[model samples]
Target: MVNDIAIIAIVGGLTGVTTVLFGFGGGFVVVPFVYQLFLRQPVVANHALHIAVATSAAVMIFNAGWATYNPQRRRNLSANILFPLTLFIGLGAVMGSLLAGQLSEAVIRLLFIFYMLVTIIDCLVSRHFLKGSEARPLSALTTTVGGTAIGTVAALLGVGGSVMTVPLLRKHGFSMKDCISHANPLSLPVALCATITYTINGWGKIPVSGFLGYISLTTLAILIVTGGVGISISQRYLPKIADGWHARLYVLLLIAVLVAMFI
Candidate 1:
């Protein structure tokens, strides 16, 4: 039991460190770690991944909220663009969370592989094309479509869908920095809604040590504490880092995670 607690602590520390460095990492790092840690207990292994993803989403509500709030206070962001899209995104997230429980682990793993591959390709091919574009007029149809797609991807992969949103916004003419800034705020609602959905859907299904719905409270606590501290520190240093270097790091991390998934 002590050994298990120690392992969980170490994993939690790593998750927090990565979360601070990147806006998201619990699903990428912690989910796999949890799976491996409980590999001998296969009955619980599948649910561990869901717990990690759901907990990570729950943790993001705090991390992303902090990241977005401080900046928004300093400079006015176009809330009008964010508000309408967020409404649909939240609704879709709930739907996606409900769907996750019905899918097989093999299907989820395959979907994760596809997601990682697409993200890697997107990072490589679109480096020069990532200029921030302007917000398009949000039509009801576009909001529903984009939100639903983002929510589905978020639920499956544990990413905030910023990878998709940032590019789409850039393509529409928003600047890269602006797109990132906007994406941060948008993630809050999506993550919050998704967390709630996963919780409700996963509630009797997950058998983690201290799970609530799909979320593991112990894991969420570790992530929140560590992630919060890490993000605070990283925010101070990230600006000094070169954009190209950051992008390269992002790609490398994704590749590493993808390889880990297969192993």
Candidate 2:
């Protein structure tokens, strides 16, 4: 347990950086860390993904909430991009959480990997995510369909929805700062809805003393504190990242997380 806490502290710190800089809300990184951690405990290894995903969802609430309140991020937020879309994201998160609870750990992991692969390919093959597009309106379809799909997949995989939202915004011609800003706020609904559903559905399931359903409260607490420190340190560099570098780094980070998942 001491070892777990130590590792979780490191994970927490990294998540904070990811949250403020990438709008990851800690999911992409945390899920893999927690999942690997649980996999080593024979007693809970079978349900490792659930615990990892649930814990990641819970952590996102704090990380995203904190980042959203950041003065710098607040300045870049676009109301037109976040309004109706966030509502649909919340609705879809509920549905995804329920569905994730029904699947086996192996199945869920595979789906997460698949999601990463597809998104990575899209980002790499497309020029839009790197170079901003022409000016475009926030379309209704993107708000409804796109937002729902992002919420569903993000919740199902415990990825905080930024993996999808950031790229979508970028493709629509938003600056990296604006896209990341929107991503942080957009992650709030997915995190809140997914955490609620996962917590409720996982009651009495994970047989660990530190667990709250599928969440490891002990790990969550440690990570939260360390993650806060990370966010504080990283947030200062938010404006330093150029638009092109930020987008490229986002894809690179995705690939890194995807590789970690496979390992």
Candidate 3:
């Protein structure tokens, strides 16, 4: 229990920084760590990935919520624009969670690996393609469709929806801070829906101590505390960063996390 608490503290700190800086739910970072932790335990080894994904989703609720709340408190978010996106994404997250419950651990890991690689490559190459291009606003219908897609994919991969939401917002002419702000809020619903579904799915299946359907409440509590501190620290810097630098930094961080995920 002491060791777990220590590890959770570290994860929470990292997650807090990542959530605020990148508008992530911290799932991309948290899932891997949790998955590896689960893997080391014999009883839950067969369901490690499922547990990891579920737990990550549960933790993301707090991470993304705080990430969004800080900006909203500053009057940075546009509710008119964010509402529809959240509705669609939230709906999709529920469906995605249901789908995820049917997949095997190996399958989930492979899918997540594929997603990380594709996203890393896309982030690296897309900068050249986007040079000099102006962001264009999408229609309401388009936004809904896009949000649904992002939510679906995010839930499956045990991540906050920001990986896709930020790019979508950027494409629609939102500034870096605005993109992060919106992405952070949008992730809340995705994480919430996924968490509920995961909890329901794992009912009567996961029999590990300190687990409630794969979510470690003890870890969640530790992470929330440290994550809050991290968010508070990172929030001060996010708005000051330039858009280009934000993208570059995001790519670097993604690469680092992906490497960590595999290692």
lDDT for residue 118 in candidate 3, whole number 0-100: 88
* TM-score of each model, in listed order: 0.80, 0.97, 0.92
User: How many clashes show up per model?
Assistant: 10, 0, 0
**lDDT scores for all predictions?**
0.65, 0.89, 0.79
Give the Å error, residue 187, model 3. Answer: 0.4
Worst 10 residues of 1 by lDDT: 127-136
Per-residue lDDT for 125-156 in model 3, tens only?
76532331465666887678887888888987
lDDT string, candidate 1, 1-263, tens digits: 56765666665555545544444435566666655655546767766566666776777687667667666422746776676777776676667777777777677778888988987887678744432234466567767888778767776556665656655555556544555566666667667776877877786885545778877787677667766666666666646444445446656777888898789
Overall local distance difference test of candidate 3? 0.79
The candidate 2 region of ten consecutive residues with least summed lDDT is 235-244
The numbered model that scores best in TM-score is 2
Model 3 bad stretches (over 4 Å): 71-74, 128-133, 236-239
Off by over 4 Å in 1: 1-22, 40-43, 72-76, 127-144, 173-175, 206-209
Pick by lDDT: 1 or 2, better one = 2
lDDT of 2 by residue, 142-205 (tens): 9899888988999999999999998888888888888888898899988998888888888887
Q: How much lDDT does candidate 1 score?
A: 0.65
Off by over 4 Å in 2: 237-239
